[model samples]
Target chain A: MHIVDGALSNPVLIGGGLLAASGVAYSLKKLEPEDLPRVGVLSAVFFVASLIHVPLGFSSVHLILNGLLGIILGWAAFPALAVALLLQAVFFGFGGLTVLGVNAVNIAVPALLVYFLCRWGLSAEKHLLAKRVADGLFLVFFLITIWAGFALYQLYQVEGGSWSVTVNSVSLILFSGVMAYGYFLYRRGILSVAGFWGFLGGSLSIFLTAVMVAISLALSGEEFGKAAEFVIVAHFPVMAVEGLLTAATIQLITKVKPELLHAVR
Target chain B: MTQVLGEVSRSWTLDKHQQTQEAFLQSLDPRVRLLVCVLFSCVVSALHDMMALTLALGIGLGLSLFARLPIWTTVRKVVVVDSFILVLVLTLPFTMPGEVIFSFWGWEASREGLFRAAEVGLKANAILFSLMALIGIMEPSVLGHALYRLKIPIKLVHLFLFTVRYIDVFYKEYKTMRMAMKARGFVPRTDLHTLRSIGYLVGMMLVRSLERSDRIMEAMKCRGFDGRFYILDTMKSGPRDRIFAVVSAVTLLGLLAVGYL
Candidate 1:
């Protein structure tokens, strides 16, 4: 999601920079002396979270963790995020300095959402361990899905001028439904290995229908993009690997030091 | 040259890494510097002609010099931060629409593009320089106070102040981790495994950070933080500040007028 230096129109770049500066400046003004240490840690966390990747079929998809970072940092998330992204752009060429504002705004919105969601949800008495985890995961999924919709729109504007608007609207709906169900499975813990294997057995009943779509698409040769899209979407091996690793890491943390979740602000 | 440039670039890419231009900053009100930042940005965007871009560049350079910023520091700020811009500048002939200055491959390079890119490069450099000058002249706390003085939303300003205030914590932890890696011989040479190791290391850092936040917040509450941070506002605009503002504005306008008419 890095906007290279010259990729945007000049007005957008400068305008975005000004807005980001405004946001960062505002964040700076609101900070208390005691909030310093947490800002440091949260910045570190947000910076590092974006580096972990899950391999997708054509390309790798990374967990942004903007949601989690925002959940933790509240209003303080933007400055930390801006700095982190700036560090990435400057050091690693992940984004351009020109579009640093755009990058900050993209990620900061979701991170802020996480803060609000947790602050409100956790404040409710009905919060359970399962609910907290679900809520966290749900927020991440929704945030990502929304951003993905925006991305599709941007791409459509680039690639599909006249049809772009309608494509965006329909794609967003389709994306939300698919993303939500996947998130549901994640929330229910069915995204794990044993649960995944159990769910695969039911799809076995409709295996022929799915196979026929593949056969017809392949025979026609023109519909391969659609077929490949399915392959891209259904590629479980990569996600399984990531999910297992994530689960293992979390389990390690929980076992080694449950105090991480125990001590709450 | 690539390695040395890369090393040099690595060292000074972050604007704050250089020695500040605090000498000129001594005389001004923080509020004026803050206004200078806005007026400078507005001028940067408003620039459309070569003469204007050049004049603005000259005046921005003068401002930096007035702040007593060293030439080397100013050069590093431009070279390191805007290399991508240099890349775009080089690519301009391919993308820009106008009369051809040169032809090669399938595309002809445009004279207009060369000029346009020069304008862009100049404008971009001016933005960086003017900002550096402001940062140089103003203490970050002063910058914060200046924003508070401007009636910017208190929440946003507080975040930047805190982030800048505590960035050292993250850097220190990063240093320790790097040192830990070095001691264990975890140097990254040419290998994808190294990338993976770095990725895992990054993951671990996030976990460590998440673990760190609760403790920090608890400590903040102990200090009677009711959310409002005050940087004792010591700045009241005086004669020098007024002159500085008027002179800068008039000079910028004169340049703008020369460019258009």
Candidate 2:
């Protein structure tokens, strides 16, 4: 997901830089001096978390965990991730200097989105409301599934099933299957409301991040369109894996130290 | 787990050892180095001409040599970064519509696409090599202080400092926890059980770290910490830093002229 230097257009790069700077400034204003230690500590934890690569079939994928970060840090996720990205670029050369802003925006915006979308559903006290929200979220997912089905059909008619189209169709079907399972569990009272929200937040954040990365690439040039589509298709497994991991992590946090979920807010 | 820990520690600790070495790049003021790196990267990324991009890459190699970066290790790092964009570089030639260079299985590889791919590869490597030389070798905390002096938000800098300080501490904590899991006959695989175990491990780490932070906050408060960190070592740019800056600016401008002409 780290777009290298020179891959992006000038306008996209500048726009990303401006947006990230403002996000850092705004989050800094909201951050209390005393809260610095906690946020910093959590930020370090996230940096380590990203280093943890979980197995997926014959290969392994490193954890992004931005969804869990958003659930924990809220707006603070932006600065924490920006600092992390900067560190990665400087020390590890995982990303480039000029494209740091674009990379941060691609990763952090979904984190911010998940923070707003999932924060309220994290409470057991709001079980009913959380359930309602989860249902509404699944409703949105159902609509997306329908839309994806149509898109897949249209692509098949036009392009007759390229690699990207196959991957897209298969992943969307897999995702819909996962959503159906979650909806089933929620209805059966197998998954708690908070767990359900965690599942949604985890997967939704990754999905959005993948989409944003694709958009940034596609917007950069016409040549990048295929690569951009491949980017989104490739991240489907990551989204599923992160979703389950996030749900499990949230469940553990709620059981061990519930306040950690609410600490940032 | 041990290999991962070793890699992390190596990346973080290697710079400290280099800081003690009498390298030319290390002698320059970090703020000047930081500014020059950002400027150089910005200029290189905008260049499209092949000759200019190659020249920019040569300058990056020169910077790395002056910095006295470990040759094989620096090359390996640059190669690793190039591999990240291997997909983009490979696909560009076939994706763009232009004069057909060759056809493979009915897929046309265009001349324009191949050139674009080479340009991207060159630009990315040039920036990466220079960036690693100038900024990557700095002590992480010193980099944070440089950012602070450069008028970045103090809170963000503070956060950066605290994070740099504790990444090692938490990684140690993480290693111990993973050891315990290993002792319990736990092995990770591509399964829900593995994901759940890792997730639980991460949650446990976060809980422990938060508790540790509370103790850290109390300890600092006892020392009468007023949220301000005093810099005992002042950063003063000397004559050498001035010369380096001037030379770098001229080289960067020259690269820009080459790009346009």
Global lDDT of model 2: 0.85
C-alpha TM-scores of all predictions: 0.60, 0.94
Angstrom error of the Cα, residue A198, model 1: value is 23
Best by TM-score: 2
Candidate 1 per-residue lDDT, tens place, B202-242, comes to 44665676566666667666887665566665557768679
What are the per-residue Cα lDDT tens digits for candidate 1 across A179-229? 455446656764532222111211211122223323332342221323322
For model 2, the docking class works out as medium
Which residues of candidate 2, in runs, are more than 4 Å off? Answer: A149-157, A160-162, B1-21
Q: What are the clashing pairs of model 2?
A: none
Taking chain A by itself, what TM-score does each prediction score? 0.55, 0.93
RMSD of 1: 11.7
Superposed Cα deviation of residue A244, candidate 1 (Å)? 13
**Interface RMSD (Å) of model 2?**
1.4
**Candidate 2, A37: how far from true, in Å?**
0.3
